[model samples]
Target: MPHCLMCTRYNRKCPGPIDAPLLFVDTSSYPSGKKPRAKKPSPPATSFDVARRFEDGRGIHGSGNLSEEMAMVWSVDISPRHVWGDAFFQNLVAFFCAEGRHVLGAVRRTPSWLHALPRMAATPPPSAARNSSVVRANEALGLALRATSAAFSSLETRSTSLLHHAYGLYGDSLRSQGRVLQERGDKGENLYMVMTSIMLSMFESVVATTGEGFASHNIACAKMIDKALEQASTGPAKGRGNNPGAGGPSPMIVNVFFHVRIQLCFVYLTTSDDRIRNDPIMDRVLLEACGWEKRRLPLNMQIITPFARLMKLQSHADYEQLAMPPTEFEHEKADFVKAKEEVDELCADICDSCPRSCYNIAYPPFSTFPKIKLNVFGFFSCQQYCTSARDGQFHHARYVSDLSRAKFVVAALL
Candidate 1:
């Protein structure tokens, strides 16, 4: 007799009689040397049935209600085979709910699409029942989240299987996103679509070995940000926006604009792609939308602006070098160096402004470290940049040296 599929795949010894019912195949009913007539197919096992099996210790014991149990089947820590299953997607959503704040850092506080994902995934919009566009977009977001989480897990475990699975999910997410955009046109500018774009960008940024894929994802994200900002500026029709309570653009949209701008700046800096560099008009629009001119910005933004400016200068220089004569390259190089110096000065100013208490909290005895350690992490990150710059080499070699020094600093501090 053939081995039971589950037992074969999971490498567990078949518990003969017990496995027969679960497999839904009755060998005794089939007579030897004769094919048995077809019987009515059994009804599919429901979540309640799965829950009972789990409760009886015949399957993995996953805590929670039936829906949760169904979702649990995909958790990497629980059942690795279901990496692309709906259950795994649910687990990914749960992971984001619990740890997304830490994983995403300061942006977590903002009311962005990511913040809305759990609710959207669990309850879904009532309109989704009637709207195919909304349904596809929502599924895309879920797939993107699951893919990104799987990619992160793959990084930690160095698991080839999980990595491949993540790519599969990412591909499906993109397909669904494309379908929604093709079908709905302007209606595709919803929060779920934006969230899908951002999540895919993050996944590409992490798992992409080459700059090409990462750069593509960044450009796509930039376009999405522009569309979203334009919609917010024009103002949606009465009762048309995602959140009725939001008088203006939601904090989430504003945060996403800033995040994408910062990310694009980094991409331009690394790739020297003029097309990917910040547009002055769009920057102005974002600044106006976020009310940056009228109010103090976060500490991180304050620090990031100078670096972004430096990169913008570098991007212009790159373009000028490509277009101008060799003799003119010297002038652009001089300009870049000057901008670099200003950035260095800004970094110094930010470091000097770092609170003494931040140093105290980051100091020693890992057990006593405060829960809010970003201050300390930020200080170290700034110091790392300074150390890397002092050597006058901004290439791969400098990165290595800076990382080594930063690790040592962290070790000593902890």
Candidate 2:
């Protein structure tokens, strides 16, 4: 049998000759002795061929194959370096080392966020990595860190782009985490997820654009902390020792505990939302985690505990003034005064025991901003309590003046 057109062109054996004769024929001018040869159809263009043609500056008119190539690019695990390049990564790392770490490090003494930095810096890019989880987490962290660094430096264009990228990675990380949780059924904790959540939460808090979203992230951090604590408490090595840091929580956990507490407090103070402020479980967990029962609280806790108490007092005063009867007002007022005095005494005691310069050496490396803001909020809370005790009948002029002073201090701190 004669070879078919396709096999003849490729020099392969043909099963059989073409079955049908050509439909159009020039019979009058046909060759006398030889049969006409069928024209060979061109082989289908492959992905590589199309890509090469496009790269060579040829116009690709086929949308279907181009669409498929574009889809594959998105579907694959593209690295941050691929999208933003090595220069961007290097600049981001430099920015992170100089400012981003310190900005987040100021939130807690233990430097939990810093724990992942070295690993991330050392790890190969996502395209070369075998573990998807680590890659996703690192991508989220890079985006968040870069976004925060850009925001702090007042780079609007860079910050906006990074913020958008960070949100996209954040969604991917969440979906990846959800799938893991479903498969594992909560048998173990996903530390990478926790770390990414913390970074994203810090990003949200620093950006200050998503107030409610930041609060929700804080809540998620709190839940993660709780689960971690429970795991630690029920570990195989339970009751190993009495010393708090001996067999107690790791530095990361400690930092996370404080970070969650401080953010929640700040959220409540700024927004006055009771959901986080009045969370009894969070309050109890924090107390235990900080080791108040052991009389060995960290320095940050020492400064924050009094403010937390004052916040509680403010919440109580609001409730009493709004809901309680006139007959019960006097007792609530006295309690409020007592709480204010206690906070005053606590501040006085801290100031007396620690020199003014020593105050800056406290845990979380109390920079001027946090130190002054802490005092501003503390004193302002006390002033509000005093005004409330006077049946909301404060001298408007003087109150406004004091508030202006406090606002100025806060502005300077910010």
Candidate 3:
């Protein structure tokens, strides 16, 4: 009953039948009791990482007309002369427009974490005197952006040159970071400095080594965000709590936290914590600080919290099954199945709701462009979900978000 009641009408399988709950197939016993690594398939351009660009063709197979990628410029928002007055920072802006924006935000579509970076990067120049702290923060942020671009390109394309470049840029960013904290550890430039740490940490998580540290140790930026909120509280003199989220919730701050939530959620999912294992409903101080009191709160409860609960359970179960000998897996297998079912069911109900209930993604009532263009009133069966993206079925962000989360739910169910 929790699944779409009209799935058969749409020529699809029901998402899942409650009577037949999905369970994990333990393959740990194969290959010397060591779980063999599953090779990840490369993501295609249409759905994700939409562009594979080589900024510098040194020691790499050049692509078709990378000139378009390089041509992403914003001549409108801020004066070209100011550009926050940092070259590396300027490149960071271009990188986001060219590749980084499409990579995460366009694919996930869950309130883009990409919104805050360029805006923060594109602020007006600080005074002519140039506050040392602000200057150092800008330089570090720009270097980190350059480093991030190189790191991702190298890993995605297996380019040795980009990898080497990423390493050098990372070191430069790191050296600048020391100066940033030592000068003004608690003052302004908190957001930019924090964003710099996040980009660098991402490079560390994926590029620096294997990616172990990014999960466990990359939480400093989140804490730094909390510090940013603290700094924002004290106004000029009175220092009354001027809530950013109070009036309408500053979009910039809200965007910052939405992005922060992604990292925090990621860390929570990957790292082992006994407390979160018992309780997945975290305080999520960052979201609160970002003022997710209205629709955003509902969105998180419906979307984020449930999925995270499912993932944390899955992560722990994976550790237990993989770490222990395959022979001992059966002892805990039943318990894992029970817990996974509850979480999976919750995510399914929230994300994959009936399309008719939403903005009716067809021609007449909802011709708001990018229609689902459902073929004669197709319905999403609660039991059946297709991972492949249809030509016109995004129906804007909600449908896309729901469909993607459902895939993870189904994957977990299996």
Candidate 4:
């Protein structure tokens, strides 16, 4: 029901249902034994060392103009001052162009194209299974999908916020253009529609990718579910397989979990899925295991509260809402800016939890928080009494205390 812009119309494109089953596979378990030994350290190599081997052949593999560019660039000893400064001047000139103005805001939004995010999967897929490659590929794919999903979630929020900001900027620009502020019909609406449309398109792309990922995970999990069921049924056990349903809710649990995953995946399949947007309700199962901590007072429900808030703000931005009165607009603008700050914090948190796979696809060191030592295990205070000779002071203290207590009790009794 918590729909994104693209998910409003493109409901059928959700891959979550198909990807639902894959979450159940116990990929963690295989060849159970003592932990594997750490590999010995290898010698370090530099970029120059590696680059030397591929120097001549570099960037020449493409079909056409690649060779020409390579030949031209390498043929001349281009001065740094000439090439680098010229390139900068070229960009400056291009920025002022009519066509460049259109994409400048969008391009400027992401200055760095690829970033390295910290990945969760430290271990490779299990080796003992015959379907090791399939399993490994699936795991890798799932990680990628999850990372994408997280990014989409983050992007959708920012996109919405941007739309809102653009609308405000359009209104301000209109005021400068000698347009009456009180008039209902303004160019802001048209500009907003165009910007909102782009945001919607982005959401559409995200949904398609998410759906594909979910479907892949689901197909793999379905096979696993079937296999798991067969093993439970045909395999010899102490008790008969009379009650197949009582597989400790193993297969069913997995089925349900991934099924929910699919539902969530597909839920955002349409921007108009009012179920997610208008009075959206979350199942208890989802609200709990979705990796968020429960709070006491304000009764915060989401696993990642800041991220959830960011998404909520994005949702508002994504949808078509009425233009507020100037006074209300100023208040909403402040709220929107606050949401943007919160979004930055949320993005930072997501980068922390799931590193390097963020917008830049490269891990930013500042994204990670400084580590503080937490005593997960509480401390215990032990009162120790050392005896001078075998059982001297300690024994005497104990005996005297007992004697005093006993005497007091006797006197009270008397």
Per-model C-alpha lDDT, please? 0.55, 0.50, 0.47, 0.30
Per-residue lDDT over 124-243 for candidate 1, one digit per residue giving the tens place of the 0 to 100 score: 677989998888888898888777877877776686766777787789999999999999987786777777787887788768976666667656666666666556545653123332
In candidate 4, what are the lDDT values of residues 302-338, reduced to their tens digit?
2223223323333443223322233433433443444
Extract clashing residue pairs from model 1. Answer: 71-87
What are the runs in model 4 whose C-alpha is more than 4 Å off? 1-120, 125-135, 138-142, 153-206, 209-224, 237-242, 248-414
Ranking by lDDT: 1, 2, 3, 4
TM-score for predicted model 3 compared with the true structure: 0.47
Per-residue lDDT, model 4, residue 274, is 51
Best by TM-score: 2
Candidate 2 — which residues are off by over 4 angstroms? Answer: 1-112, 118-155, 158-163, 185-190, 206-208, 234-246, 272-274, 285-294, 316-352, 355-414
User: Candidate 2 — number of clashing residue pairs?
Assistant: 0
**lDDT (10s digit) by residue, model 2, range 1-414:** 223554556565444445534332324466674557899999987654543343234535544454654765633333333333343344443433233224322422333356454465346355536655455555555544444443333343544544444454456556655654555555424455566566666556556665877777777767777776666655754334443344556766666666676666666556556676666655654434533333355554554554454445445433332343455445555555654565555556656765565443232322444434344344434444345445433343433333333323322222
lDDT of 3 by residue, 1-414 (tens): 423444444444665676432533334468776678899997653311211232221223434554675667433333222322243244443443333223211222233454455555546245514686677677787777667766665666686765776777788888888787887766644667777877777667656454445643245566666556554554333123455344432445555655566566655554466643343223444224343333324333334443443344344333323333444335434433433343345434444654544433222332321233221111222112211113322222332333334333322211
What is the Cα-based lDDT of residue 102 in candidate 1?
42
Candidate 2 vs candidate 3, TM-score winner? 2
For model 2 the local lDDT of residue 95 reads: 38
| 351: Cα error in model 3, Å | 12
